[model samples]
Target chain A: MRYETLREQIIALELGRRERQFIPIGLSAIDDALQGGLDLGAMHEVTGPAAVFFTQMILRQKRGGAFWLATSSPNEEYYPPGMAQYGGQPEEVISVCLPDTKDLLKVAYEVLAANVVGCVLLEVQKPLTQTQMRKLQIAVQNTDSLGLVTRGAHTGTTSPERESACGSAITRWYVTVVDWSHEKTQIELYLVKNRRGSPCRWIVEIDHATYDLHLVSVSGE
Target chain B: MQRMICIWFPFLESERLIRQNHDLATRPFALVMREANRAFVSALSRNAGNMGFAPGMSLADVRAAAPDMLYFDADPMRDIRCLQGLLRWASRFTPRVSRGGGHNLYLDIAGASHLFGGEDVLLEKIETQLEDFGFTTRLALADSKAAAWGFTHFGSTKSNITTERLEGAARELPVEALRLSYASTALCQRLGLKKIGELTKLSRVALTSRLGLDGVCRIDRFFGRTAEVTEFARHKKRLIEEEQFFDPLATNAGVEAALERMLEKLCQRLSGMRQGVRKSQLQLDRVDHETMFFSIQLTRPSIDVNLLKRLFLHHFDQIDVGFGIDRLILVAEQVAPLSCHQLSLENSQTQNREQDLEKLINELSNMVGARYVQRFFPVDSHIPERTFSRVAALYASRLEEWQSPSGTRPLRILKKPVSVLLRDGIEKMAPETVFWHGRKCHLTPLSGPERIEPDWWRDDPDWRSGGRDYWWAKADFGALLWLYRVSDEEKTQWFVHGLGS
Candidate 1:
C-alpha cells in the first residue's frame, strides 16, 4: 500500500502546479500604499524622473534573488547608487547588458525563461512595441516568474505599445515622479491595471538623508 | 456594557510606594501627583503617608504636613514607558491589550479565565507580579467598566468579584465609587440618594431630567446598561518581528547584524506556521525621514533565515544610509508549505553525469549570455538547403541527429547553398571532382536525386525560382557533401549539412 502511494506521488510530481509566493516590502507605508506588496507573478513598471528609487525599493522588497539585465547605449551610464544602498549585493544581482537592444531583450527573455530566476529586472531605453512586449510577457508567464521592466524616459522615446500580450498578469504599475525640487523628491506610483481591483496611485517623498521613500499621500483614481 | 477589567496601579512609583517596608526602595518617599500639577496624589509611599501626608493635598500643604517627607515630581512618560513594559510582560496571558489614561491597563480576560485554571489563579498570578513590583493594585473585574471601577476602589479582600457577578457586588459600594462628577454627587446628595443601589433603582427619565446627557452616560456605564469599545492599538499588518536601536546604525555591517537577528526571529515564526518564504523584504527605516529597502528572493522556498541573510548580502551595497537606520523591519512574503524532496533510486553515476551537465550548461549559459546556447533540430526536407533548424540553448535533449539512410552528408554545411556549373546534364557536386586547389581524380560516388518542392508559404515572388533535386555525394578525401539541382539551371547547388562524425 505504501509503495502504491509512493508510485502515485511520483507520478503526480511530474504534473505539479507552479508555486507562487510573495514577500512583503517592509515599508508599511508602501505596502499599505500598494494594497499589499507587488504581486509576485506580474510585471511592475517603474517610470518617472527617478524610477531607480522605486526600482531599488521593489528590488529590496523581493529579497528573493533577481536577475537584473540593464541595457544601455555605449555612451549612456547606469551608476545607480541605490543598488548598494538597498542591500543589493554584488553576487545576487545577475547582470546581462549589451549595446544592442534586441540582443539585450533576447538575453533578458532567455534568462527569465530559464525558470531559475526568482524575479527579473530589465532596464531598457524606450517602450517596447506591443509584439515585443508580448513576447517577454509570454516568457515570464510561461516560466512563472516576476518580470519587472524599467523604461526611463531620459533614455529615449516613451510611447505606449499597441497591445500587451496574452497572460492574465496579476498586476501592472506605472511609477512616475510627481514632484522633485528644493532638496526634496516625491514619487507618484500609478497602478495602471490590476485584474483584482480598480487602479490606485500613491505619492511618496524620497528622503534624501536615509534614501528612504515616505508616503506623502495616496489617491485612488 | 461588555466587561472591561481596567487594572489601575495607584502607587506605581517604587520610591513613592506606600509599602509596608522601611527605607522604601531607596529614593525620596512621596506620592508624586499622577498628572503632576493636576494635583491628584498619583502614588504615596508608606513613609510619606505616615508623616501625616495624603493624596490630593497641595504640594505646599504636603510639604507643610511632613517637612522631612522627601518629595519628587511625577514623570508620566517614564510611568507609561514602565507600564508598557509591564504590559508586554503581561501579554503572555492574552493577546488583547488596552492601556489608556495614566497607569490603567484594561485586560479583557473574561473568556480566558478557565484557560489559566480560573479567575483566582489568573488574579493570583497578576497579584504576585504586582506584589513583586511593589505596586498597590486595586484589581476589579465586572460586566461594566464603571462597576469594575467602583469595585476596584471600594471592595474588600473577601469580595472575590468576578465580571459575571459584579452587578450585585457593586450595590453595596459607596455611590462615590461610581466616579460621579462632584456636581452629580452633590445633586444625588441633595436628592438624599447616596448609595449606588439607590441610583440603580431610579427611573432613567428622572435621572436624565436631573443631570442631562452626562448623567445618563454615567448611570448607563455604572449600571452595565451601555457598551464601550476600547481601541487597543495593534500593528497595522501582522508583524512577525520588530526591533529598534537607540543609536541609529550607519554602517552596512551594523545594519546587516541587526537584520540577522530579525531574520532569526522571522524564521522562528515562519517555521511555527509550517511554511517557508519565497521572498523577504528588508526595510532599513531611518529616523530623519529616510528609508532604504532590500528585497531578497530565494531560489527555492525556504524558512532558513541564515540563507535569507546570505542572499541579502549581495544587494547590501544598494542601501544608501544618508543619515542612519534606527529601525529595521523584515517581512517575509510569498509563503507556502515546504515540499519535501524525495531522492530517486537512480544510482550515483547517472546523477553525477546529470549534475555535471547541468553545471556545465549553467556556467556556459551565464558566461556567454543565456541566449547564445543552441542545438540543431531536423528540418523536414530531403533538399540539403532545407534540412535543419537552429534551436536555442540547453533545452534540447541531445545534439545528435539521424543521418539520411541512403546519403553521405558533409563535413560542413554552407550557410546558403552555392550554385556551381554542371557538365552535360550531370552535376559537378563531388568535392574531389570539382577541383578546389585544382586536385581531382579521386574515387567519387554520387547518389540519385531526391526532389523537394518550394516552401510556397515562405516563397517570395522574386526568390521562388522553382523546385530542386538533391543528391548525396562522397569523395575519396573522406568528405561527404550534399548537392542539389535547380530545374531551370544547368548547374547543381552544393551545400554540406553534416559529417558522419
Candidate 2:
C-alpha cells in the first residue's frame, strides 16, 4: 500500500455517488454540461485562442488563496493589475515565477500536493504523459482544491492524436474566439473530453461591465 | 481585584556570567569582587554552593577549600542591563510591568489573569519562558505587593495567595522580606527576633526605642497595617535587548538564534505597549570588539514577531562577525500605537490569507530581484505605458483605483513601437499592405484616425517627434495591432504601437 497522506485521505472520502462541489462560473449551460461545476481536486485542461479569458474568469470564481505558477514567457506572463481589473483579487493571488526551465512541471507537482494553498494554476505548452497524469489524477482525485493547467492556442504544427487520444484531464476544453470587439467578446468552448458525460460545445458571451461570463446558447458544432 | 506579581531572579550577577560562559553551568565557579586589596565571593554557581562556597566569603577561604575552582569578576552594570531585558520580556504578560530595583520585576496584573487562562497558568507561562532563557526564578502573586515580594525573596519560590490570607503569608516570612538595612536585620537577628511574627509581638514603642521608626514601619508594611510605597522604575522607551558571550558564536545560525531572542524581547515590549515597530536595527558585537549593524525601515508599523524574524533572516549572512560575535543587540528606534481591530473568527481566515500574501510578496521580492515581481500604479499621463507606472512589489501599497481607458486597449502592448513602411508609395491614406519590420504585412483598418494632438506647453519627448493619428488594424493571423502615423505630412510615418487581445 502507498503511504496515505491528508490529501489522499480527502480524495478517498470523496469517493461516492455524490458530485463534487464547484465554484460557479456564473454561466448556466457551461455549468450544466460540466456535471454541475468545476471540481477542486481534478485538473481542468483549458486550451484555445480564447482560453486565457475563460481561465481568468474561472480563476476569479475560486474564492480563496491561489498559487499561480507563472514563467518569463512574454505572452504567457500574467499581469497583476490587469488580472485584478478583470475581477480577480490581486492580493489574495500569489504568483510563483519560475526561471526559464523544464523543472516547472516538477515544481507544479510539489505545489499541488502540498495543500497549503486553495488553488494551483500552471501554464504550459505541452500536455502531461499518461504516467504523469495518472499520478496527478490520484493526487487530487477527490479534494476540494481546483488544479488548472493551461496550454496556449495550438498552432497547426503540433499533433493532437498523441494527447487527445486518451485525455487524462477530468475535463478538457478548447476555446476559440467567435466574436471579439470593444463592445462585446464571445467565445465558443468545445468540450473535447469529459469524464462525467459526453463532449459538447457552448457559445458564451462575456459581460463587458462586470466581466461575468454567460452562455448565449448551445451549438451542435 | 488588583493583584501584584513579583518575579524574583536570584543571583542575577552569577547567572549573567554563566550565560556568557555556558561552560561554567556544570562546573563549580564563583563570581568575586575586590574590596580594599582583598577578593570576596559575590555570587556562586550551583556546584560551588553544593561544594560549600557562599557569597561574601573571603576568596582566600574559598580558595583554601577548593583550590581548583574557577572564579570570574562580577560586573554589576552588566547584571542590571540583563535584568532590564527580563523586565521587557515580562511586559508581554501585562503592560503595568515595572522593575523593583536590582533583581525583582513587578507587574500589576489586576484583571489580566483571565486573558492568560488564570493566575496559575500565567505564572506557569512566566516560569517556562524564563527557563527557556536559562534563568531560575521565584514567582509569587498576592493582593499586596509587599506580600508578593515577601513570599518571593524571603519565604518560598511559589506563592499564589488571595488578599484575605495576606497577613498569614507575611507572618511566616522572615524579616528579609522587609528589605531592611544590614544593620537592622543583624540587630533583629541578634535580639532573638528573626521572623516577622516574632517581632510583631513586641510593643511598637519598644520596637521603636531599639530600631527606630524605619524598622517599625517595615514591620507594619509587611503586616499590611501600613502601605508599602515601592518606587517603581520608570519604563525605558529606548527598548534594546542584548546577549553577551564569552566564547563568541561562530556560525550564522547561532547569530540568527541570538538575534531572534533579541527581536522576541523587543517585539514583546512593543506589543505590551500596544505599539508597533516602525524602524529597528540589529547590532552584532564581535569578540574583537567590532560592531556590525543591520537596520530596517517600514512604511507601516508592525509588531509581528515572525515577520521581523523573516526580514532579519535575509540579512543574517551579511553580518561580518570577524572573530565570532560575542554580543547581539536589537533596538526599536521608532514605534507607533497599533490600531485596534474588531477581531472575529470569520475574518481570521481572511486575516491569515492577507498575512500569508504579504509574507509571500516579501520573500518573492527577495528571491528574484525586486524588478521581476512588479505591480503597476496609475500615473497621470496620456501615453499608454505612462498611464500606469511599474513599482517594485515591495513598495506597492493598497491600490486606490485605476481609471479604465475610454476606448478599448490592447492586452499586450509592445514596449517600443515597430515602424511600419508603405508597400509602394508614401501617399496612401491607409496601407493595404505594409512592409512591417521583416515581413510584408497586410493591414485592414477596423477603426481609424483618432487624431491626438501634441501638448505644446510641456517639452514632451515621446510626442516631440510630432502629433499622431491612431488606428486599430488587423494583420495576417488575425493579430490586432494599434497603428499610429505622425501628424506631420512630411514625416507621415506609421508604426505598430501595441497588440490587442
Q: Which candidate comes out best when scored by TM-score? A: 2
Model 1 docking category? incorrect
Model 2 bad stretches (over 4 Å): A1-19, A41-51, A59-176, A188-203, A207-220, B1-240, B248-253, B279-300, B314-334, B344-356, B359-376, B391-399, B419-444, B454-460, B474-479, B487-494
Error of 1 at B23 (Å): 6.1
Predicted candidate 1 versus true structure: per-residue lDDT over B1-501, tens digit per residue: 254566777666653233435455554466566443455555566555665666667766666656766666666677787788777766666667678675677777767777889767887778788777677677776677666666777776413565556667677777788777899889889988877777878888888888778878877777667776677646234535667889888899998888888888887887887878766678778889777766655434677666677667756777787778888877876677776755578676555544444433444343444454433445555444455554433344444433442233332234444444333335343333443223442424345466666767786452366775556544333333355555455544443332211
lDDT of 2 by residue, B1-501 (tens): 458899988867767777888987888888889989989998898778888778999999999989999988888888888988887787778878877865888888998889999998999899888888888899899876777788887766677887777767667777777777789889988988777877777888999988888888776665566876655556665788879888899999888788777788887888888899877788888888888887765545788887778777766767776879888888888888886666788789767755555555565554444555555566665655566666665667556555566455554455566776867577667756777546675667767777766667877777788777778766643345667887464656887776544
Give the Cα lDDT of each candidate. Answer: 0.58, 0.70
lDDT of 1 by residue, A8-71 (tens): 4542332232443445655575565455565555555655434555666666655545666665
TM-score of chain A of 1: 0.68
| Residue B107 in model 2: lDDT | 87
DockQ of each: 0.01, 0.08
The stretch of ten residues in a row with the least summed lDDT in candidate 2 chain B is B363-372
